[model samples]
Target: MSVISDVSIPPARTAAVSRRFYITAWRWHFYAGLYVAPFMLMLAVTGLIMLWTATISGRDGEKIYSVAPQASLAPVSAQAEAAFGEVAGQIVQYIAPRTAEQASLFRVNQGDASYMVAVDPYTAKALGHWDRRNGLYDLADSIHGTLLIGDVGDRLIEIAAGFGIVLVITGLYLWWPRDNSGFSSVLVPQLSAKGRQLWKSLHLSIGFYVSLILVVFLLSGLTWAGVWGEKFTQAWSTFPAEKWDNVPLSDLTHASLNYNGVKEVPWALEQTQMPASGSQAGISGTPEGQPVTLDAIITLARALGFDQRFQLGFPASETGVWSISRDTMSNDSANPLHDRIVHIDQYTGRILADVGFADYGLAGKAMAAGIAFHEGDMGLWNLVLVTAFCLAIIFLSVSGFVMWFKRRPRGATRLVAPTVSEPGPLWKTGAIVMLGVSLLFPLSGAVLVAVLLLDLLVIRHIAPLKKTLS
Candidate 1:
């Protein structure tokens, strides 16, 4: 038959098939909704709040430099002395200058600008703000991340992510076409101006297109759930680290030492060693004459092909350390835009650790790329795509519910229970086989087994309550 002629389904057969599909979809949808709807709603609301984040927060300030100045990447002890004077007593701490700097910046909290200064190591000139801005992005981040509810909010989101996976799986099963003829009906919407055509098209069409992305969104979200999920990813990704396997207790007591113009002092970083897990390593502070420059550092990092946006944290004190972390555009995780860390010594202006993209193992890179993709930072185009998908998900979920509620029958199915009858013993045997296969995903499998046991042993056998409930 021609593709167009294939559309001609008998009315009785079509209605019968539609009835079966609706019953199956409705049954699972009802159960899944009972289990997951609240969590899904929580995600939807949080997502919407995050969409407007760039407007609410303030930007953290950065150091501003002039072309006429050329300074050394030196330590900041001398600059601290000149800036604070002798009475400034006990260099307490220094702020790392936000520069490709060799200078250790310091803050005396002497007056109005208690917020640290990014001082020049050679000239002692004060630089700009060191903290990030608080803008709409921060507000959206907080809403998406913690709902302003702290730990409780995080836990709720984690649970929601877990529930989301189940919803997707059950939704697929419920949506699957039963026969070859049912394929078009399940996959596409009818164009004939019949009941709820556009609504049906919107729901089914969107869900079909976004199935893969939705799955990634749900799975990536689970990475934040807890230690269990963390370990699961670590294992799946095969992340390796042997250096932290052994630690000498004696190494903990001794503090590293540093020097002021006329005196020596103790510092924490000097005594500590980074674990061998491919962590970025760098010494703390710039040398007395060789100050690090922020612009220089950015150029260096870019040379390493980390042309993505980065945030530089200046050393807070003469004893403070400089740090740089690559920043991604958003929450998508599949893009490898931000998998880098850098540390530089503030005292001598030496590269402590510059972990490049190539330095990470296979799994680490995959994890990084996944994170980038999830954040919608793969590129500008993906950002638009993900935003569109998010809107589609929200719309589909609402429409699907509306369709179900509108067509639901008024009476209980109790009268048909006896006539419906149980599946044959062979069916039970097949269920056991299926349960065996499901056990690979331990958590989901255990839940399924428990559910099956409860249904068979309790729901089916408990006659009095079964009659009333059914």
Candidate 2:
């Protein structure tokens, strides 16, 4: 019952206009496809790998628990001792806790790959050993993150994100319904045009509906990948201190907003001997101070009720701090966990600057939130939405290619359009200049320019002698 729904057009004119708009969209899709397909394929493949990681991890339907159901999790100190003793006489260097449950595991690098030794916190009983890269989960994650090529692969992912944004914009332009005749063609699949028109509608409609999701997914992903990744991290570092203003705790507005060199302070500034100083050459050992074992730090942290799965960083200087950053994955607003930085005195083993989780700025909180969003950890609803979006992308890419293939030339007859009469010299020159600017943002634009060159110089000129070329 829509106003335009009943409108009709002359059959001949309708056919002519519909074909024109369809070709324009097809050509735009063609140019963009040739430029971005390689990157898209890589992203698609890597995305598949990442999705498979979640599927494989959950395949068994068994709950992965760090703590034993029967036995209580022992004190952090005792758990560390048991784990160390179990792995003793094995040339061990450092042992760290992954969870509060003594049954939790720690990573050990023996040779080529890391090993996980699961231990009971109460008695330090060795549960089992697991290879770091034995399963598809590890392989999928590695490929998704680094493409198995490390930093170089990461750069490619970032570039893909940038171009993906362009592809989205251009696709919107090409999909824009020009007139009433093409409205049905743009919105709904054609059941009567064999399977070809049906696919065209499927691809166009899906692209239109999922446009926002695709853009957000790509941008958020870009925020994690390249030089933008550094920016995103720095931006999130300010989140902690921002929330303190409204909280009931002590005032934090006067605290330094800058985090530069904040973690560099010595644990015992005005006290006795410092921990060992870090070497200039590499990550050196602590100076000639009493060594703080993982057990001791874990004991202190647990006594303070720091949640499990937290990461512990050793002091940098001999007088350095032993920083224990509490895990934020499980924190709710009411019982928030502060990313802690405990300046433990190396000599007296006393706690110095015990900056709790509330010490971070607004940037830090935002960063944590951003990471949670990317990992599909925001909530079950978010995970479901992201999964749906990813599947939509797979469909869009495949359907787009299929539509292109179906419209391709056959035998000695190509569906060739006449040359678009060149615009005035100034207009053509100005348009190219504007396109050059677009190229700066999306490398795909440059690829489009190259394809135009091939089309104008080769395809168009050769179209007249199609039989010879064929």
lDDT by candidate, in order shown: 0.48, 0.49
TM-score of 1: 0.60
TM-score of each model, in listed order: 0.60, 0.63
Best by lDDT: 2
Predicted candidate 1 versus true structure: per-residue lDDT over 1-470, tens digit per residue: 65555578787766665555445444544554554565555565555445424212111222233222365544344555554652343333343333343333443443332333445556665444332223344455566656678767666566555545555654665566755557678677666645566676666666777778887876655554443243454445432222223311222111222211100111112223322212234333333364456545545555555432344445544445445545332221224543454555544555555554455556455545555555565657766776787777777667766765545456754422212232222334334434543543344455556767888889879897667544
Off by over 4 Å in 2: 1-28, 41-45, 51-67, 81-102, 111-113, 133-135, 181-193, 227-296, 299-305, 313-321, 326-367, 411-470
Among all windows of 10 consecutive residues in model 2, the one with the lowest summed lDDT is 261-270
Model 2, position 77, has a per-residue lDDT of: 51
- Which regions in candidate 1 have their CA more than 4 angstroms from the true location? 1-26, 55-156, 173-186, 193-201, 235-308, 315-320, 329-338, 410-470
